[model samples]
Target: MPCYLGIDVGTSAVKALLVDEEQRTMADATIPLETSRPQDLWSEQDPETWWAAVQTAVERLCIRAPAAFSGIEGIGLSGQMHGAVLLDERGQPLRPAILWNDGRSFQEAEELRRFHPELSRTMGVIPMPGFTAPKLLWLARHEPETFRAMRMVLSPKDFIRLKLTGVCITEMSDAAGTWWLDEAARDWSDEALAATGLDRLRMPELIEGSAPSGMVRPEIARAWGLRGDVTVSGGAGDAAAGAVGLGAIDDGSAFISLGTSGQLFVTTHRFSPAPETLVHSFCHALPGRWFQMAAMLNGASCLAWAAGLLKSEVPGLLRQTEAAYRGPSPLIFLPYLAGERTPHNNPYARGVFFGLSPETQPVDMIQAVLEGVAFSFADAKACLVQAGTQLSYAGLIGGGSRSAFWAQIFANVLNIPLSRYEGSETGPAFGAARLARLAATGEAPETVCSAPAVIETIEPQPRLVDRYGPRVDAFRRLYRALEPEFRNAPTGW
Candidate 1:
């Protein structure tokens, strides 16, 4: 049977997935990666490491399942969005890629907001420190020589795609996060690029996620033990592709992702900019579909940190908190480990635990952490609703969604029905594989991107509703009360 391969160049690792026409996983492999933080609030990674990880992942996948890897007909690329990978004319990176989590551009982001007062309105996103535009401005100011040497800029996955096909191209979904795209028009905005000292020539050619962007080079194909004619789809940003994996294409369809960074994503058919609230409005992986998203910079990573702190595994921690979830704990956690994105674009915001007392136990803290994340997603839902996007239900995906305890809290806190689909746990890699199928077969996306079988539906429980309702108010108020202090907090606190 013919198969498709989807590779996601994520922040912490590169994931390679192989799937057949019916969306059955044939083989999957992941290669670990690391980020360099030479300075405070700055994140960088070598683009060469990303390409090397991709190669290692693909090689392992082929070794694991040679039959499926040999039958692969098309390739799709997905990755962490908003990363700035500057390259020279020779197609070599001039400097380490500035990552999405990097905060060295916070001042530049504020400067852009002032210089281009209408930027949020035009770009449908507030220029946050995590965006690509401000990162470029930072480079131009701090590393002028390297900046002048930059002949092209690409997102993380596009850098890998270029290595594979010798083509530099990006899709609407990823481009939308770059602070350059005119999301409503589904193309790069001249004004936005000019503000960042970039022009159209430095930007990658735009394409829809499902469209054929290029083909694998002969050498890459031969080295990877694949066909030379493998088609390449213009894959999506990780969130958009995750939405596609959940089949959240129809208007008002939403999904709550609990990956390294959490996001509450709602699909929209029309352009709806909520920049005032720092909500992300971007193009969908599928053409003609747009989405409004509220992102939380901290997600499952928080739990991982907590697990490490408590000297226990995540599963054991959840089990220990079972009793604590029977009622709401007075302790409230702010899940802003990496600062925040939605509703507040405060990069300086630090994680805090409010209402902590002498009686608080580890179990209580764990429960509070889970509830805090749920409340954060609830805030995103409120922002979407306030912006006039009505959500009836949302699909739940990502690593943390594997925990029944957390999934239950998300459904009750958001007060919406949550559906868990089969195979969605694979997230963006699965979606990219489907996009690969679309590129290779020329099939309608509706036919190829069908939602997987729904295995369970979680509705809000009255007890959970009553318990978390008032706590949600406290969660919001605490952030507001502390916002000023957060702004005034000393550096490196």
Candidate 2:
């Protein structure tokens, strides 16, 4: 039986999974990654570290299931989107890759939007600081030397692909987030590229997520003990991969992703642009499909930060908070630890606890953090609705989806049923494996990309929804009140 390997170069870690033809995950491994914040509102990482982590992850998986690993016939790649990986003529990184959560390019993004307001409808998103084009523009101004030396730009996963196959390519889902892809055309937009001082030559070849981009280099194949050069599929960005994993390919199929960053994504059959509401209209991993997404800058990262500050493990802290939960916590947290996206699009906004007092307990803090993240999703839902996308129900995927308590809070906060599936935390990796299968066997996507077995459908309890209703109002009011403050924040922060 043939096996396929899927790797996700995530913001927090590199995860690899080996799956057989029967859709059984044979082995899995993960290697943690770190981000460097050299200055305020900036997040970056050395592109080489991603490639190193990928190698280690695959090595661990190979050790765990050598039989299955040796039978691997295809490889797929997925990763966080909107990262700017500038490369020299030798395909060497010029500077640290600016991440999706980084906000140092806010001015550049604003400038781009100001000059080319009309492009948003075709580009599918208002050029935000988090997008790649703005980051490149920032570099061109602040680090002109590095920008001049840059010969190519690749997304994070495609950087790893460069190492794997000595080839450069990116799929539509990931490219769509770059603010340079023409979503309606499903191709590069020269007009948009010109705004960033780039052209088609700087971009990698664009392909659909399930299409074959290249083969694993023979040296890599030999090291991995593969039978031959494995076919490498052009996998998706994390969001689209998660959607594919959940089989959210049809019109109006919706899901929420709670990874390092968060997203409320809805699949659509047509390319419907909705930039007025700050909702992202981007291409889906599959061809001839698009999605509207409200992307949040912070998500499970808030929980991680809280856990670290409290010097506690996440699981234990969550258990404590759930046990102590009655209604809402005594505090309302703004989950803008790394600023916010979606409805606000405010990069200067920082985390705040509005109701902390002498009576505040540790568990109360944790609960507030969880509630704050849920409330942020509520903001995302509101944006999607404003963009004319309705969410009667949605699937939940990513590292945060493993928390039953968190999922329940989301269900109540959003007032919609959420489907949870087994191994949902690795949805992108599994989805990549599905794409690998399609590439290796020439299988029809519909047959290979079926939804996995769902463990439960979390429904909104009326009592909980009613309890959260007033608090949601307060949350919105708090953000509105603080918007001016965030804008005028002291220079140090």
Candidate 3:
């Protein structure tokens, strides 16, 4: 039986998945990765760690399913988007890979927004510190030596592709996040690159997400004990890859991705730029498709942090919160642990717990955190609507999809049905495998990208929806009231 491999270089972990021609997953392995924070608002990871983790994950999957692994014919790459990996002359990393969540480039992003205001529509969205271009600007100013020595720039997964294929190439979806890609044209913009003192030469070649970039190196194939020349497909950024995995390819197909960070992704048949709303409009993994997304820096990770602070496990806290659930928590939380995106593009925004009282219990705080995340999704839904895409329903995927309680909360908060599919949590990697199949077999994506079976659908409870109306309004008011303070506050505060 022929098999395909999908490897996702995610922030918290690298996941490797192997699937047979029948589309059944045979083996999966996840290897944890570490991020470094030498200073506040900075997140970096060693590119070498990603390479090592990929090897380990693939080795583990091979060991788990030797027969299936040996039949691997194609490989797909997927990972976190907007990470800036600077390479030196010998393709050596000049510095740690600055991640998507890093906020050190806020001022640079602001400068770009002011000077290149016209570029927003072409680039998909207003420049943010989290985007790759602003990171380059920040480096050019503070670490000019490193910037001058830079030979190339690659996103997180493409960096892994460099090791696998001995070629530096990226797909449209990932490239769209770089603040360099012309979204409507689905190609890199020379003018945009020049904004950061870069040219096309320093950038990777572009391809459609399912197109083959190059064959895996012979040494890499032999070391992994593969059967033939493994073709590596240009997969996608994690968000688009997740959309592919969920089979959300048609116009207006939408989903909610609640991982370490969250995104409200709506597929479009054409490039629909919504720069004013701060919603990302970019090319989809499949050809002739695009998507509008509202990205939030905080997601399920906020729950994990709350759990740690409350000295409990996530499962335990969720269970307690669910059991003690009432109409709504009086308290409200701003899930801005790493600042925010979408509706509010404030990187300086900090997390705040309001309405805290001596009468508040741990369960109330837990419920508030969950509701805060739910409210954040509400903002996402509103922004997508403002961008002219009304969502009828949304598929739920990523680590947070495991919680039925949270799914119901999102449903009530958004007042729309939330659908959860079988194996939704395996989103990016599974989607990558599908892209691999497309690359290797030259198969049509419609047959190959069929939506998975829906396991459950949570409908909005009318009473709960009505109750959340006031709370959501209050959430918006609090953010608007606090916006000026956040902008004026000192960074370290």
Candidate closest to the true structure, highest lDDT: 3
Misplaced by over 4 Å in model 2 are: 491-493
lDDT of 3 by residue, 1-493 (tens): 9999999999999999999999999999999998888887899999999999999999899899999999999999999999999999899999999999999999999999999999999999999999999999999999999999999999999999999989999999999999999999888999999999999999999999999999999889889998658899999999999998999998888899999899999999988888998899999999999999999999999998899998899998889899999778999999998889878887888899999989999999988998999999999988888988898899999999999999999999999999999989989999999999999889999999989999999999999999999999999999999988987877664
Per-candidate TM equals 0.97, 0.99, 0.98
Q: Which ten residues in a row have the lowest lDDT in candidate 1?
A: 322-331
Q: Write the per-residue lDDT of candidate 2 for residues 1-493, one digit (tens) a residue.
A: 7999999999999999999989899999999999999898999999999989998998899899999998999999999999999999999999899999999999999999999999999999799999999999999899999999998999999998899899999999999999999999999999999999999998999999999999988898888788766999999999999888888888998989999999999999999898989999999998889999999999999999999999999999999999888987769999998988788888899999898788888899999899999999998898888888888999999999999999999999999999998889998999888888887888877898888789899999999999998998999899999989987887556
lDDT of 1 by residue, 1-493 (tens): 8899999888878888999877888889888899888876888999999998988988889888899899999999899999999999999999899988888899999999998989787788789999999999999999999999999999999998999999999999999999999999998999999999989999999999999999999999999988879999999999999988888888888898898888889988999997877789889988889999988888888888888888989898898898556677788899887778887887877788988788888888888888888888888888877877777888989888787778888888888889887866678988898888899998988888778888789998988788889999999899989988987887665
lDDT of each prediction vs. the true structure?
0.88, 0.92, 0.93
RMSD list, candidates in order: 1.4, 1.0, 1.1
Provide the clashing-pair count of each candidate structure: 0, 0, 0
Tell me how many residue pairs clash in candidate 1: 0
**What CA RMSD would candidate 2 show?**
1.0
The order by descending TM-score is 2, 3, 1
**Order of candidates by lDDT, top first?**
3, 2, 1
> Distance from true position, residue 153, model 3, in Å?
0.3
